[model samples]
Target: MIWEVFRQEKEGEYHTHCGNVHAPDREMAKQFAAIQHGRRKPTNNMWVVPKEEVGEVDGEKYSFGGTTDKSYRWATGYNVTADDASEVVESSDEQEDAERRRSEVV
Candidate 1:
């Protein structure tokens, strides 16, 4: 059977399960997974289990929370501070003009 493997990079980030591989046994599963999931340079780790082992929750059937006057209760989700609005100003006018001159010379 074919089993899917997934790896999570950081907190609040979704796990990206790359692909599926079929194997007749656990040793074969690991071998196939090592090639499929481990061959990449950035492969951190993976969850290798049988196809029948994993449980799934469907999107429609999954309940986030009950519907009610949720604004005050779930206010944390909507809160954003002014510091979040700050943008990264990487380059300035002088740097841009210098780069333009170098590009023109090239």
Candidate 2:
């Protein structure tokens, strides 16, 4: 059986697929994944999932976020006064930048 290994380099970060390991069971898969990929990198966490359990969806099968414009979801769509909090302002700025980038992409 084959097991896919996902490694997370830091805390609260995303786990990316590093590689796969062939093992008879889940326990052996974890051991193999740790030795093969986790030893060299700064691994915060690891996930060993069976290949058959994973599911995927392609662009042809479904449309993500739909075809219509969803400007209401953006922070800029709402009218609001400037806040005194730095975090709020930073988040708004990030949202604005994301909206701008998305517009450019489309």
Candidate 3:
């Protein structure tokens, strides 16, 4: 099974996908993932998804970077001359409904 580790960054914030873990079942995998990824800090919640249950499709090329030479791929790429935050412009309105996030570290 495929499982994902979601970490709560702060109070009143939804858990974010820190990483994924794979195992036979959701419960066991979550147990493992929690210790490996979340036990170091105070995690509000954890979700373990069977690898088979987690569905993701990588685009033919790169769905995230519409074109080549992506400025979006760099660490400080967003510290650009543009007035708009690249993430805000690219993210759909639906994503905004999920939760707002801020962190000193991921």
Best by lDDT: 2
- Tens digit of per-residue lDDT, candidate 3, span 8-68: 8677898777888767776778778878888788887776655556677778655675467
Candidate 2 TM-score, true structure as reference: 0.60
Models 1 onward score TM values of 0.51, 0.60, 0.45
Candidate 2, 1-106: lDDT as tens digits: 9999999999999999999999999999999999999999899999999999988999888878878978899988777765646688899899999999999999
Please list the C-alpha lDDT of all candidates, in the order they appear: 0.72, 0.94, 0.70
Which candidate tops TM-score?
2
- For candidate 2, the clash count comes to 0
- List the pairs of residues colliding in candidate 1: none
Each candidate's number of clashing pairs is 0, 0, 4
RMSD of each: 8.3, 13.0, 14.6
- Stretches of candidate 1 above 4 Å error? 8-15, 65-106
TM-score: model 1 vs. ground truth: 0.51
